[model samples]
Target chain A: MSRWGRRPQLSFPDVGSIEGPLLEVVDLHTSFRTGRGLVRAVDGVSFNLARGHTLGVVGESGSGKTVLSRSIMGLVPGTNVERSGTVRLSGHDITAMSLDELREVWGMQIALVFQDPMTALNPVVRIGRQITESLRLRAGLDRKAAYETSVALLKSVGIPAPEQRLRNYPHELSGGMRQRVMIAIALACGPKLLLADEPTTGLDVTVQAQILDLLAAQQRERHMGMILVTHDLGVVANRTDDIVVMYAGRVVEQAPTAELFARTRMPYTEALLRSIPRLAEASHTRLRAIPGRPPDLATELKGCRFAPRCPYAQDHCRKEEPPLRAAGQGHLFRCWYPVGSAEGDAALAYNVAARVPAALAFTGIPVRDAALVAPNAVGSA
Target chain B: MLRFIATRLVQLVVICFLISVFAFLLVHLLPGDPTLAILGPNDTPAARAVLLHQLGLNKGLVSQYGTWIMNIFHGNLGASFLTKQTVTNALGVAVPIDLELVVVSQVLALLVAIPMALIAALRPNRLFDRIATTSTFAMLSLPTFVAGPLLVLVFAVTLKWVPATGFDRLSQGLGQNLKSVILPSVALAIGSVTVYYRLLRADLIATLQEDFVTMARSKGLSTRYILMRHVMRPSSFSLLAGAGISIGTLFTGAFVVEVLFQLPGIGYQLVQAIYSRDYLVVQGMALVAAVAFVVVNFGVDFLLTILDPRVRRA
Candidate 1:
């Protein structure tokens, strides 16, 4: 191995020594003006990520999770795309930075791992060249130094016989191995932040665990802040320090991971949790699928965008938008009637009694009892 | 790679045999008797029979084919019916002119088309792309007959850049030969450039949309690096495939170009031979053309495999 962690001739932003959180995104909006209309892909998404902390942005398809990560890095491309926000990296405003300035930030200060490894790595280029490109060009390393650093990067990402692998093209490697190569390329510059947008997607179950574990190990070793963007809540449940649940281009709920899970207020968040398959359940148990598609982002939307699919959606939820309100310190959610809350249980009971399809679907759980337990826990604490 | 080459060689042989059979059949397929074409309307019953006997046409069809094939294998292309000149000698004069024209035109086409497509692809539908796209389409509609004369009128007649019409051998002087061939090469090359540019531009636009290109951009690679390193080769697949069939223009003599420019390439000879019913010359030229077409396509396939490793499985 060619000396891991030795970034000779390369500059790195000192982690944890910064005055503020590693990244601060305030009222970030990324929208595309398509033929249909203006599509607000990421609408007013805001969050702060501390150095060495892992924040999970959880959502289903088209939930704007991916766009949020890209917006923060200033990586969103397209002439028609418009981004309005304040994204500060290490106290410097990233969103206001020009493209030439952003180029220096990308891969050196903030790098991204794309979703599909099959298509992420350039198929024709050798694994070595793809990894060493940033080193030679951006880091000002010579050919031999870049070559050695590339092999070391491949080794750090856990590729075996990285020297031999350096000569192999992407097609020669398996999907898992290609992702590792992608990780190596992203990590080649040793950026302070790693935004992995669905990193383990499209891999086997066994390989998924390994890839996620490798990401965690690398994140901890480098003390880099990471934004794990995935649709699967279970993927981030134990791995992340904080979680943001997005719906229709907006974050509906967010909290520290354990606190969010224990006192999950949003019905959408509760529904997401129930949707994950549990091993304790009997084989062939029917999966709890979230009902209805997400609202069309092109059309102007008011109120809670998740109202139509939410089990405890009330009339007020249909009429007016719910502002982000805190359930506890650092725990924010948007809902008129939250899950495990007194109003949430009443709305659920009323809906089930009135034969509302969404609420009746989840009547298998004792909604009232859960709400009762939550209030007592809140009072005691 | 060796296996790919081996398979292509097998294919080339099979293709050549098919061409040979077609060439042999052409005399019978088109209403023609080599001796009748040669003797004119003079009283020639005995002479015709003597010529037929010498030609081995007195034998049955299968035997005639076998004899013809064997004669060709021995490097004997019989004398032209019209001129009484050996078919091999006529081809010896014509082939070099055609080879030069085809090679120069195709090289010129690729040299211009590659960069044109690349720049156009960078900003698709923008001013540069639209202008290039429109100009190529306009050129694509102009056949070689029209384009060849138009070029001569502009560059040769009006501008007095070079001789309007002539054929000079390279041994005379490379400069005179190039000057003689310039108009025809541009005329022939315009069509190829249009085709290659359109194909490569479309493919490059599509390739730029691929996920890997975005990944490259995310790596802080410059636009040029992402385009050249990640985009160009994958985008060239269709252009390479188009070049395979277009190579036919190389040997099919580009009749309009040769005749218009007064270059005695194989195409001009083939047309002249057809008019005079010089069946032996036609047969020889046809066989050479078919072989050239197949060989060029095999080379295209070989180049494609080198560009894209995914094709190595074939």
Candidate 2:
């Protein structure tokens, strides 16, 4: 009989010998077959999340952060997309599992909090039904029991008038309330790992913090692994135990969150930190926007994907790609000359002196303004 | 909700009145003299005038319209000039047959359309989808008259499973009545099935891509469960609206099918009355059909508001 036939036994078996990481992703690659060419949405990425730890995935749009999360969850949309990787959740290699087998993992072992609360819910369904759905499906709870549990879950998510809210539709609730309901539903089955992809993207600034805090508190309470994917560095700064910064479908840098901020090695990571709009800055300060567009995934590139926009790119940087290497204890980055190293500084000075127009053209700043920004950037590096 | 329904009901009344007036004028404004047709074209002018005055046709158009409207309020639909039978009684005998045909055809169309559309939507661009699409297209291209005869030839003549070109009332044995309607219903339903299949397939495809469907999958709901609960309901809203308008068309198509099959339906009665210049019967049937269309559309609106909270809030 399948696992869902009986009441779930909470006692986990000791699968001996292969006592691996709680969640292990090895060299995951997800590519899509577009009309023009193959677009590598996620290429050669890997990470581990121990139980009770939060892994923050930081990247801009099209950085494959969303696809990486989906790939891990086995939720990638179409057969046209090719994926090769091993996603071992508590020793089972889920990468090769069919969709039917994946059902046992989803909700019971893993759950996801989608990005848009507005569209992430069935508009016609009541909030109570949405929350109770997983409870009934995964836990085999009866309708009344599931509904009561849903009410409790709503209360746990800090929703007021939980009973009333349960009867209301998604559109009847405010954005914050709907997001809280989404969280409630994600937690309904007591998942071992929760993948929250930009859980606060479209919400108001004030509500974003509340939702993030709620997720963090729930994670701590349940002691579940979490992968928080976001484009904003500030969101994961204090929330995540570790951070992985991706660029052009590959991880550019990975390190402990504090270490990543304090002694960042990748130029892209350093540039990202510099671009954050600090509240301490003087009023009306111009935010330093990143230069150039993200690399076109449809095209093949010869070298480091960021070289064209990197201020420290040498000729060799354009000819050869740099592999991810350890720069410091528990720190890994893909860069020929690590940021803050003497070689990196010298390369930046050489590129500046060479008057490389292509490298500077991406900044959209005049030469004089770039010259002014260069010293401060180099000093930070 | 009550207020909305009340307002719609008022509008329904106005619509029915307008339809009555249009039907009355259309019969009256025909090039041939209705009075002459009734009295015989060879009759003397004095005789024609006497017949016209006796029949109240000598009254002005406004007075005639007023009298017709007042009689409608009193449940009188005037009298057929040919048989002198009350139009209401003629309709009473015919309306049930048309209603049964329309209802049965619609039900049959939905039964075939929804599942096929859903299957086509499930794995779009696949073999099942392609076959369903092609077949529906072929079905759509075949008009009712052609399909009706073809059904007769296959089921009535070849297989001899059902009687050819006739209808049995439900007051008869249920099985016999169903057997009689099977061919006609299937023939009448082909076009609707094609339309509904296409509309629902498109909508279901779009609905399946919605984030809610992904969310349902994330909850570990079975594919069948997700399709039935999450995808089907929302996708069906458009199908329901389309079905509402198609009800009107179905009635029109039923006229051809009923006449072809020699069924004693409103369509048959209306066609026969028109050929024989039975103006009262034509007017009554036209008004009834128009009223049904309006009422059905109103019901669709009410159902939509119930199904979609957005429409309700609006």
Candidate 3:
């Protein structure tokens, strides 16, 4: 044991998955029973992350990224939550563990760094007291030892005058320092899996870059699996090894960092990439804006969740919900007819043909010849 | 902190001045005249008018108020109309007895209330919590007057263990006086403790949900240690606020308890003064009560700032 006390060392289960990834989530479906009905926040979402790898979960607001992280930590509040599916960490099934069992694994096997460090830390308490509270409880450390360890934790996160800063309240620290303190707190027990929920959302762009670099360095040093949830594609594009694109509570696409950018099958993933303004590109061209808002969760969707927004959606896409089929060796997409390249006559024809059959099946809107119609209004004409 | 104190002091002065004016007007506007009440019904009209003038009733309302406030701003609190002695001197002797009673009652109430709250929180849906809830509800419904006689019947009339009425000061070698104060303090505290337990238990339960407490549990701290070191300290902030409000309202409740126990407090003196229609004494006692309220509120505010850093920063 360490100097503080005898803390049980967490054992990684041998599930004969050395050839595979360290963590695997299989068909995870989490729902909350509201007054209206079961709000399926996450439906059949799956991904895996190996040791020393960064998995970026990119989605719009209310797309279930935060809930997914909280589920992994077993920290979902409210009585209406109903979780299902297997979440295997080091080959152990963590989905069925009780809260007491989860407590033993928390901070030592898995830790969470939440968004908004200011709200996460208590305002009425000193930094030292808040940090040492866990140590004193779990490690059987007395006050003096806990205080010393707290100062050490502060220094590890690169805060200057760590000893004095421990005595200061959270309000006394800046946004960046507070986030660093959060990271320090998460890393206190040296966990293997670190789930960070938009860890640098409210900070300046420069500070955001610095914090991401810090987390990257820590993950590499500890050989830990990190899941970074963010909306900024630029932030994760260069940092993450793999990317899982979520749309309307389902995994729409999954690919390696380079492959996902080079070859995206799902129209939503392509739209997200196209929406980002490239400073290196020609300045005269306008930034592409994704048409329509996200799907309302209160409504029950019948087909593919992104079919209403996808430019290349076909009749089958509207009649049947598309599952994640293999687009390549590692790339996956939920669209029946996936589109990868930029806009062309063939791409336009493909989009028009896809919508015409679906519209015919639903509203009986006859398909018009593109050659006879007006050039500006292809779908309407 | 200094600015807060300065503002409170200004407020205290303004409140005391307004109270004096209201008390003076109330006494003067009543049907009975203080001179006749003190002099009896057979007194001559000429004698009453002469006495009224000497007491400064011939002056305008504004002039009388200004003089009363001026006397109060100095060391003087005016003279009692019936006793014809300095009000400060009379209060100097009576105030300590009231203080003794209030302190003892509040201490006893807190002692019982804290344990009840702890038991209630610890056993939440179990028998202990149910019993505490039932007993507190029963105590809350019972008024001090009813409880006083019931205690008298059980302890004094039936058991014959102690005297049922009156009080003796601590100066009498601390035996009979201390013993005499116990029954009254217990009777007063029973009602107050019921209210206190309800507040404290709610606070304790609320504190149990905080993130720091969750972190403490993850650290593998014992449940008792977490409750004592983390949960209790933060929860006390709310309890301190409730305690402050209770002390502020204590004087209002003190009137009923004092009358039941036959204690010589300012509340009793005010009641006797009102019955006799001694206008000057009533006005003097009202001003003192107003000042006491402002001082007590100010003290509670400071205590809150000391106990809670959020309040201090705010």
Candidate 2, CAPRI quality class derived from DockQ: medium
Every model: Cα RMSD to truth: 5.2, 3.4, 6.0
Consecutive 10-residue window with the lowest summed lDDT within model 1 chain B? B32-41
- The reply for model 2, stretches above 4 Å from the true place, is A1-20, A357-381
Worst 10 residues of 2 chain A by lDDT: A372-381
Best by DockQ: 2
- Preferred candidate (lDDT higher): 2 or 3: 2
True contacts kept of each: 0.53, 0.62, 0.23
lDDT of 2 by residue, B43-159 (tens): 899998888888788899889889887988899998899888999998887777777788889999999999999899988999999999999999999998899999999989999
Per-residue error (Å), model 3, residue B108: 6.4
lDDT of 2 by residue, A327-377 (tens): 677789999877889988787666665555433542434556555553322
- Candidate 2 vs candidate 3: the TM-score winner is 2
Model 2 TM-score (B-chain only): 0.96
Clashing residue pairs in candidate 3 are A137-B219, A137-B220, A137-B221, A138-B219, A138-B220
- Supply every candidate's count of residue pairs whose N, Cα or C atoms clash at under 3 angstroms: 0, 0, 5
| Candidate 1 root-mean-square deviation in Å | 5.2
* lDDT at A228, model 2: 99
Model 3 DockQ reads 0.30
